[model samples]
Target: MVLLLGIAAGLAYGLTAFAGAFLAVPLLVLFADVDYHRALPIALFALGICAAIAAGDAVRARQCDVQLSAWLMAGSLPTMLILGALAQRLSEPVLGTIFLIASLVFGPLLLLTLRAYANRMAPPPAALLDAPRRSFTDATTVVHRSTADKVGVLFAGVGCGALAALAAAPGALLGWRILERRLAGQPHLSVGTLALASAVLATLAAGWQFLFVADVPGYTAGLYVLGTTAGMGIARRAHKWLPQAPTHRALGCLVVIAALALWVVVVRGATAST
Candidate 1:
């Protein structure tokens, strides 16, 4: 049962960058009979491993931007550690409520953004559209970091870290939106950079959980790692063969489903407590 849960969680993580941690946490609680607090750390640890694998693949494919990832991490790592420590002190209900609220607020926005981008209807300026694509392998293709871009990265990092620490995979969706806005016309690079940044942030968050919160289950973690590795491999191969429009639509639907599940959990917890 534990192995099966891990595999299911991993498959969810492997399939979508935005919804993995979000999907994992609640699913862990519901399916694995884990408490919300325990589920959080487990999901974080599993997500870190999965993100690392995905990032490695992105790097190997020359799709990731190292400099961009570094800047995002600089802002995200410290914030994640601090918030993760704080999260340890919060009660399960409070954490669940927070996740529920975040899901409701951001879920629809994410869905809309995905649809807009998929349809090429996002209102990015023509100048951004004309900006040159940065090559992961070729430093010459890298553009100078503008002040605005740096600020955007910093803000996005803080938001990502805060969300990662609180509950669910807020970082992935937040990072995706930020990267998409800043790196217009370069969807592949945005996705690659988001993966790498998420990996780093999730790893740090997991480390904090291990050190301060509780000991993670080895069997579950190991199985989740295995599942994530396999899922990412499959996703990478299948992505090319799939159409973007349908994929984006599917992801949007997933965000909605996850959000609804979180809401139900929060409501049930409230009713039971009352």
Candidate 2:
């Protein structure tokens, strides 16, 4: 079952992986009895693999965005180090509660952010960035925006680090929602980059936690990796024929949100009981 789930998860990350780790963590911890202690690392490990695959795809698509990736890494790595160092001080319940609250709170904030982003004035179309925004194959299309808007690029990197540490959600999870707003009029990061970023961040985060925080049997983390991979596989099969029309996409998002909401409630209740 673990192996099966891990494969399913791998596919999910491979495809619309924006939220694979977020999608996988609760399920693995809640359903598979993979305690939070081990669950996060396992999810991260699988996410790492997912990131590598996405990176490959980005390279193929001529959108690798090497500069962006480097900047993102700069922001994410330090936080990862800080969070990993302190993960032990934070218990599973604390992390879970934080995850739950963050999800609950983020929805409204996201709405407001989206609205603000939408209302921004557009820059003249013909005016271009100093460099034509040239980047690798699998990168987001270059866009022109207010100088103030461009600076937030740093926020992407720093926030990714903090969020990945806090709740293991950096992909289409919170990051996607936020980016969707900021990049509304432009091509988003190549899906490949999004997926690979998830995998890489998750893997690194998981590795750090496993080495320093959790002391479970070695095999347990292996199960976590297996479980996430299987989950990705399942998600991949589900998305095989998924249409990306606006209607279909909206419906899909609602379904995932609903299911995740229910799962979260169930987990909270179970945790309270146990």
Candidate 3:
């Protein structure tokens, strides 16, 4: 059961670049009867490895933005360390409730955002086809960033790191949204930048878990690693051939599904306990 759950979680992590911890921790608690604390650390460790591999792929593809990644990680690393320590002291029920609330709130908002983006990308009526359009060069030109933009990026990074430490990946979801807004028309670069930052954050959080929070088993970690590697390979290949529209829509749906699953786990556990 543990191995099966690990693989399932790893596949989620690799394909979406999020949700491994979200899926793994709850499944571990419910099915394998592992405590939330122990489950989280193991999941974090596995996710760290998965993110590292994905980041490498992104860098090799020349889709990563090193300056953006560095600025994001500057705020994330210390925040992760602090929040990870705090997570160790929280009760399982408290953590579960937090996860439940986050899922409910963020899930619908994300779905709505995706729908809106899709609408924006849809073609206009034939009457408008003759209307003047911005030149390709003008449309793709990189925008200058203000101080507010830099601050927003840093804030998003801190938020992402904190959530990750607490066994959630919604922070990464939020980071992606922020990046997408800032780096419009460059989806690959925005995603790759986030991937690199996520790799660093996950690794630091996992190391903290190993040293202070829990002792993860080698076999369980191995299973997750294997599954994530396979999933990453599949996703990488698919990205080459698939259109961006459908891919974004699919990702939005997957986030909703994962969020609902998390809510069910926490709510059911709470009800059972009471």
Candidate 4:
């Protein structure tokens, strides 16, 4: 069951950077009967591997900007560690509830964004949400020069880290969205850079949580990694022909379903205990 779950999760990760972790956490809680806290670290560990594979694919395809990814990680890693540790101190039920709320928020938002993009509508005008005003064409891609400001990149990283620490799954959606705007018309670059940055953050955060914050089930985590590895290989091969919009629609629906399922579990557990 865990292995199967990993494959599904990995496929999601490979196709769309946000869905792998988003799918894993709640599915683990629902099927494996794992606690929310433990599920978080386990999903994140496997997600790191998937992210690495995705990043490598992007690099090979010349879709990634390595330097930009580095700057994003510089601010994100430490923030994720600090906030994740703090989040660990919260009660199990509280943590689960937080993840549930985040899922509810991000799932529909993602779908909405997809709809807007599909129609060729403009995004919001906020500084963070707007497309970078200045861009220059390069041999490989169009570089959004204004988006590379060190301060802005760091701030975006910090925000992404906070979101990740709070709910590892939803954070990826927002992170992807932010990058999508900055790297407009460069879908692969946005996904690749975020994947690279997230891979480092997720791995370190998983390690820290395993050592100090939670007792990660080694057997379960190992199975997930194995499954994820296989699934990612398949995704890499089929990436060219994959229908991204349909895939994201499925993801949005599944995420909402998972969140509702998790809520039921939380409520049942609370009632039983009370």
Which lDDT tens digits does candidate 2 get at residues 1-274? 6665566555544444233345556656655667665666666666776566545544554533444455456667788768756655676657666666655555334344434544432211001111134354324555455545334545576677776776666534444443334545433343433444555676778778777644664565576576655544444345535432322234234325633553565567568979
CA shift of 200, model 4, Å: 0.9
Clashing pairs in model 3? none
Q: What tens digits encode model 1's per-residue C-alpha lDDT throughout 160-218?
A: 88888888474767777778777777666677777788877887787777676565566
lDDT digits (tens) for residues 1-274 of candidate 4:
9889888877776666454567787778888778777777787788778777765655555555666677778778888888788777876667778778877887888788778777532221110112232233442563556654656667778877776676665266656666776667766567667777877888877777666544567888799788987777777666557566787778778887887888888888878888
TM-score of 2: 0.68
How far does residue 141 in candidate 3 sit from its true spot (Å)? Answer: 13
Better of 2 and 4 by lDDT: 4
For all predictions, the C-alpha RMSD in Å is: 5.0, 7.3, 7.2, 5.8
| lDDT: worst 10-residue window of model 2 | 122-131
Q: Estimate every model's Cα lDDT from 0 to 1.
A: 0.67, 0.52, 0.63, 0.69
By lDDT, the candidates rank as: 4, 1, 3, 2
Q: Please give the ranking of all candidate structures by TM-score, highest first, separated by commas.
A: 4, 1, 3, 2
TM-scores for all candidates: the values are: 0.83, 0.68, 0.77, 0.84
In terms of lDDT, the poorest run of 10 residues in model 1 is: 122-131
- How much is the lDDT of residue 10 in candidate 2? 58
Native-referenced Cα lDDT, model 2: 0.52
Tens-place lDDT digits, model 3, residues 1-274: 6666665665555444333345656666667666667766666766676667666756655556676777788778888888788887887678876766665556555556656776433211111112233355544465567878788888888888877888646266777777777777766566667877877788778778667654556676566556655555554444445554454445545545655565567667778898
